[model samples]
Target: MITSKLMRPLTTGGVLASTVLFASGCKSMIVFDPKGPIGEQQRDLIYFTMLLCLIILVPVLLIAAWIVWRYRDRKNNRAPYQPVWSHSTKLEIVWWGIPIVIIVVLAVVTARYTYALDPAKPIESDKKPVTIQVTSLDWKWLFQYPEQGIATVNYLAIPERTPIKFELTSDGPMNGFWVPQLGGMIYTMSGMATTMYLQADEPGNYMGTGANFTGRDFAKMGFTAKALPQKDFDRWVADAKASGNALTEEGYQTLAKPGTTDRMTFASIPSGLFERIVHDYSMSRGAPPGYTLRAVTLSEEKKAEHTAHPKNGQLPPGNGAQKDAPDAQSLGQPDHRSGHMHLIHGK
Candidate 1:
């Protein structure tokens, strides 16, 4: 059955598979090559967890192979014959106790990091965070720089070492917002805005994409995240602001339609557009009796709400509001600088 014809095809297939594997292994792994603080911490945790598993895995595998070889049924096996030996208290304790101790250690370390690396937690930097609104569309991603007054489709830009507060929401199904080299994936769901704080420590070109399944054009839902120096970022913003393609209400409506398109930029965007989107999505035509949620949209308006207790005001960005969330002043503000309207929307 092992003829030359069959052998030829098998050899060719093996060579092709090896070549593909070698080529793939040569490619860059963005996660392992983290350029940001969050990404680096996450990568460390991954390596630690993997090594911890290997601590158990390696020894268990080696012992299993040794047991198989040493205890095999052979003509002259030298292994001890303890076939009826199963229950030893010392053995049970060693086997069960080792795994239990490892699990506890893992749980403790994991819990510590889970709290430390929270996506909402602010970075310890002197620079005021730049706020960017992110909207996941039918098959595209939209980014609006509220402070910079510019918007881009399938693209992102930020200054190095400055924290970026991304307010994420979706016009369609829940999509995963991920920039692998910056941090982990944060979800953008319809009817609500989710908060994520990410920063890049180095100037580099990075790729971003929707990490969840959407529809037929899901593969095309990728974007570029470029980290530039402060001066260069400002220059880019100024150039975009000088451009003529302003996105108005009508323009945004057209852009929101379900289709894939090339990179787009707008010199200006309608005010309160992001707040309106969150409000509209949350306020359905027929939401039951009274289902309303306070969204964390404008960090500026939220800032004014916190200056009531000036001590908390000193706290950076989102931290103060969260600490004093139960305070009446923290609920919503009377007006927003972006829209000059009530920050809170009623049913």
Candidate 2:
């Protein structure tokens, strides 16, 4: 070994190694081997925005460096203190106007791609888009294909290049939906709905998980998005339907329970289950039984009549009805009735 007095070589080698290791850990720095159109757009958006940002950033950095170097203090530390010259109309215009233009360009580009990737818009190809209703539960995803009449947990299968429309909502409030390679994240809240559209270009399994932290096992709230050939996807659906365990309303109540590490499957789904889930029927059903009774508003005149004459329509104060004079006294007590008595009492 060559004799080295200074640790400069070893220190420099260690620094270089650390830099390489850290850079390797960044997912973006890795090459894009996209398996979907959504993935391609995501990667392109990253690079395009990065380049646009650098156009302004790099020049500002260079000017800062040049100014620092040129005005650096020397033994002759004479420098002009021109505090009043700090506000330059031209410089201000350049800074503000350039950023505005950049933002406009970015916004236009983003909107174009976003609409192109809209899930509600069906592709014009021969392939019909897969419709999946996704319900986010405490720690799992429930995917129901109404057309296929089948349901699955922790797995979803779609054909490559075929668009998918996911109608998403939560079993409860503690969840968010995301598939990093597919599209942006959306919230999944009870009594509310959100949608996401995506199309994969290759046949493979991609990992996706809930991006929001809910509770324990949030890390495990993941599902496998499988892009299969059309034939394979059809087969999967057929198999699911043939499995025989139908997901009924009662079955869904069990599936929607809280706590974690739960999973369930359905050979087929009961008719109208998907519609019910999407239309917030569960929330409606969960309402108190008597709450369903309509409360008809009484007009001021009607209210006055009801107050003056009081009967079955009026609010009950003491109890039901007094049959006779002695019953009105109730063997001893005077019923406090003036307001409601006329309505309840006949004639």
Candidate 3:
């Protein structure tokens, strides 16, 4: 009867655990389902560290359990008790020595992997790595293929078995760029560029997104990374060129607006666009051209009007001359007197 009762609860618990595991499907676990060389290395490191920790954890847990059971107070009090006992040199040495050795091993392994997995570190390959410039917008991702002379919004394409070097920056706010099945996450910051290297060993589609919580629409910031064979990738590039959609300065500004956007492809982009973007944010430039100038001018105008007409206390008329102001149809053209244009490079 006792054996049967014990078996009933054990069977029920085992069934429940299995059901839970079944409900959480393996497909949802991307870390364990890595598809790239970088991800495989990262997964291996995780497993190594976990195994090292378990080596210590299991014994400590077992010892605690044994001590609790054997030293439990009972009527017979057979367990040895020495109230005056202070310390054991052997026990101290064993505990301290083991942890010190584990720390030394962990430190060595960590340092080795840290340098080996650096995103900027080049991977050994016969074929040259492809470079892609990535810009994180308010709620979207923009990918510029400088070598291919094409760009895409919220979509990325790479050739399989080839290293891809990604240069990341943010046009809106700081965020994390991550493709969990391909590699580790890296931060994208304004006024700076970061690098990450990744390569897919097989042809497949992987999910990528901004891992950091940036803004209200952050949840919608995601993109698809498709890895294809060299031939297929070339075909896709040809198709993108046939699409005949060119990315211009004005179009980029519009796309950078804070909102969700669908995936899009561009046939061509202006030369040195990525370089200009970095230069605009660099310390030498100090601030984005036209951004601070307009704000300062507007503030000075408001202040001057208030000071000149203290009794009226009214703001000045817009831009001081309505006749010279460009019409709505000619909005992009520069206003001669103000020397200001709404669009960058008058695009």
Candidate 4:
């Protein structure tokens, strides 16, 4: 009667706990519901690690329960009592050897997966990968499709079953780009470019967001990644072109300003826009200047002379260097070497 009473509450508690866990498991988790090859690989790694851990966890738990039940302070119990026992060579070896073997296996699997799933590594696909330039803005994401000659803000569209090569940078503070169902996160830093490759096996809309804490609006820094069939993707590009929105230099300047913005699309974009953005950010550390491109082929002698004596700590100028060139700093323009100048009022 006493044992039955004690077991009743434990049985009820176990059932309650199982019910709660079952209910929680019904919810969909993106990591488990992967839609792409990269995500599947990551999910497999997670499951593999969990199963390996359970190999030790289950045996230890079972042994602990058996010891508690068989050695409990019961009137008729006859379990062995080794109060003075120091150690057992077999037990020690079993415990240590099992864990070491598990570790070795895990390490090998982890290393293999790490190399196979490197973000920068290209996906194995016969189709040519689509290159997308990603720029993390103050509170939004800008994607430029150079091949398609179009751009979109806070929305990325790609063709299903095709590899995507993402070249990422940031115009605002440092941020992380992540598409949970597609692949892992990659950092986007200003003045430096990073690359990641991802793909979707089927048509669907996945949520992409900035995984790093950026600013006040970081929570809202999200975008939609839509994967569609080839025909649909081409139609999207055509529709974007018909929208008549052009991402011009002046327009981008305004759009690049710090603030949140709704989804936007451009039908056309200036050629070499992505390169210019990267170059401008790298060179000026501010907005891109309307500087004229003047290529000068310098002879070896001229190069040596320029290297020996840099003009105003600047690289040797080509023939186009004016004798009385205006000082960019004095003119309140961005200094090529010193970066942008911030003017203080009433100083």
**RMSD each, Å:** 15.6, 10.5, 9.0, 11.7
Residue-wise C-alpha lDDT for candidate 4, range 221-278, written one tens digit per residue: 9999999999999999999999998999899888888889999999988887767767
Decoy 3 TM-score against native? 0.76
CA error at residue 31 for candidate 2, angstroms: 11
Candidate models: Cα lDDT each: 0.84, 0.70, 0.84, 0.85
How do all models score by TM-score? 0.75, 0.69, 0.76, 0.75
Residues 1-347, candidate 1: write the lDDT tens digits.
Answer: 66988999999999999999986874578888888989999999998898889889999999999999876799776778666756799989998998898899999999998998999898888999999999999789999999888999999989999999999999887899999999999999888898999999999999899999988898999999999999999999999998889999998888888899999899999999998888887776223333233444444444555666566645355555556444345445533433322233332
Winning model by lDDT = 4
Instruction: Please give me the total number of clashing residue pairs in predicted model 4.
Output: 0
Clashing pairs in 3: none
lDDT of 2 by residue, 66-168 (tens): 9998877787767777666466899889989999999999999989887876655555566677888888887788888888778888777888889888888
Off by over 4 Å in 4: 1-27, 72-82, 286-347
Model 3 over residues 24-94: C-alpha lDDT tens digits?
87558898789998999998888888888988999999999999988678887675766786899999999
Off by over 4 Å in 2: 1-33, 75-93, 280-347
The 10-residue segment of model 4 with minimum total lDDT is 292-301
Candidate 1, number of clashes? 0
Worst 10 residues of 2 by lDDT: 338-347
